[model samples]
Target: MNFKSLKTLAVNGKQVIVRVDFNVPIKDGRVIDPSRIQAALPTINFLCEQKCRIILLTHLGKPKATHDPACSLQPVFEYLAAILPGVKFAPIVPGTAEAITRSQEVRPGDILLFDNLRFHTGESENDLDFAKNLAALGEIYINEAFSVCHRKAASVSTLPTLLPSAAGFQLQKEVEFLQKIMEKPQRPFIGIIGGAKISTKLPVIRALLEKVDYLLLGGALANTILKAQGIAVGKSLIEESMVSEVKDLNLVTNKLRVPIDVVMAPSVEPDALSQTVAVANVPDEQRILDIGPETLELYKMILQTAKTVVWNGPMGYFELPQFEQGTKQLAEIIAGLNAETVAGGGETLEAINQLKLNDKFTFLSTGGGAMLAFLEGKPLPGLEPLTIE
Candidate 1:
């Protein structure tokens, strides 16, 4: 569905309900990261300028029934005050008439943030009564929360059915950018798949094989592959169950590139004795925390000639200094690439910052699970319902 813009929805000084992803980390009752808040500015600013009465809805950390002060939207209000100082902020609790009453007071250029939507069990259950009640707040709904698009919640999937819905700027950008990769990526596309478990990344791996010219494996997932190839992984955390399956998969895809060498330590501890070994032989006591030097050079060589690159996950358990080399070097390679580069996943996102290459990549996605689900060809519940506009 071709969604109307915010400008198209705000008619007759209507109350516009916007669904946003304010699920950012909080530390010591303070917002530690404001990146998600920053991403929503364009949409918020546009609605305000249109003179629409704006009411925003979002959910924070998981909370039980009734109000939990810990999961309150107070921190998000505080964050908005800084990034959008001129906009007024108010908090509304879901499922209460007070929320709608408070929202009615918002004038043009004003903003009101609702309390944590999860406070009501109906939000996740998609209760029709709860959806209709939320629908009462506005005549129009705008979905700007791409991070939770995979979820079917009151604020994301259900509410849009009660009002004329549209896609917010960030959501639109996510669709357009990801569509490029699926449709017509540049030639010799290099796909780097990583992350902790083989199970989580299996769909993306299968998807990439159909389009990627070269597929490079890393992180804990690579450990399984290494073991599948008769390598002694040592004390490295290897999934015993996946090793045999990977060996079976190898028979179908000869294009898969597993690490040739790796950096290992007796344990993940920093001071542990570190050494490199060929993929064939690793000490039984030492764990393979990261990829080794030879593999880094091989990956770098592949990146140099690629016309497109898509990456997910980190190459190693990069939180520790001993195993950070693989992820760090991979980040450097992505930053220096002459190709069109796009990367996602939480660990990879953190590694990009640690390597100081956040600004160098073509695009760094804010959604991890949503990104993977999109590549897997799954419908995004948050986006699907909002398409009715």
Candidate 2:
């Protein structure tokens, strides 16, 4: 974590290779959300100011060695050129020796973007030869891709072994921002953790239990908790083994709030039969899909009182319009908060955007698995190798 940032690196005459997360959503060959590209702008702009020769590297979509046209980075190159007209694109096809030779021609203040790394088998496999070839392109390396920091790939995990590496502004910011919560946060640090499975989120929930003053559980996991308490959860999904853990954690009490009522449906589809029922008295044939209004009110009060709040995942099946009300309300509550609010995960971001509250939070992390892995006190391979000196 003691890696040198852009501030410590001299870029006036150096060929700087920056690893950024430009894996944005694409539809009809158009970039839908430019948030990931925008997140790396501070570093991009800074390096430009320093007159550094910029070599941008990123993976677009999952592409095999045969090169799928749909996974090409050509559209990304076009989008970036529009965002930064001064930065010229120098294409480097992955796996080709020509890539290194092409990189040799890069001049100071010029910007080059390499093609999709996944198109080359070595990139994903962490081939040493490929790493050395990539390292030869730059005098220094800057990792700004927090979203892919958890992966131990050739570019992110191995390239640093051959060249001096540093953390970019975006990576440093994400570390510093999350570090605040790792340390003892302000009093009433409420945490809301939700998603579909108890098995998947068990580690996060266990970790938060030791720190958070209040923990709110919802979504499919809430049904499991309710079922464990001997309450009728109906046709909702339940993890039978988690009942003991839920009981041991004392989640039945006020410290960890589960829904008192839930919005139930026969199926997850929008056209399914739906109704709301008390959690304790759910019908045997109905499947609970979302938290009821009463639960939203309880969660809102906790949000209002929190000085620092960290949230991940959706409170309900937010993709469905009928079940979106609870998640939407939660986003509204988060939007109105004056506290330091940090949200992560794909569903959480979607709910925030749907509620038109993306700008309201203190920070919206671009990472998903990387964020959760970091929160669990695990090391990120892409970030661990970078040194401050």
Best by TM-score: 2
Over 4 Å off, model 1: 1-4, 64-70, 86-92, 238-245, 251-254, 269-273
lDDT of candidate 1 over 61-158, digit per residue (tens): 89865788889888788878876745555555765788777766777767778888898888989888898888888778888888888887777788
Provide the TM-score for each candidate, comma-separated: 0.89, 0.90
lDDT of each: 0.80, 0.82
Q: Residue by residue across 208-299, what tens digits does model 2's lDDT show?
A: 87788998888888777777778888888888888777665675467788887888888888698778878887888888888999989878
RMSD to true structure for each model, in Å: 2.7, 2.6
Write down the RMSD of candidate 1 (Cα, Å): 2.7
Count of steric clashes across candidates, in order:
5, 1
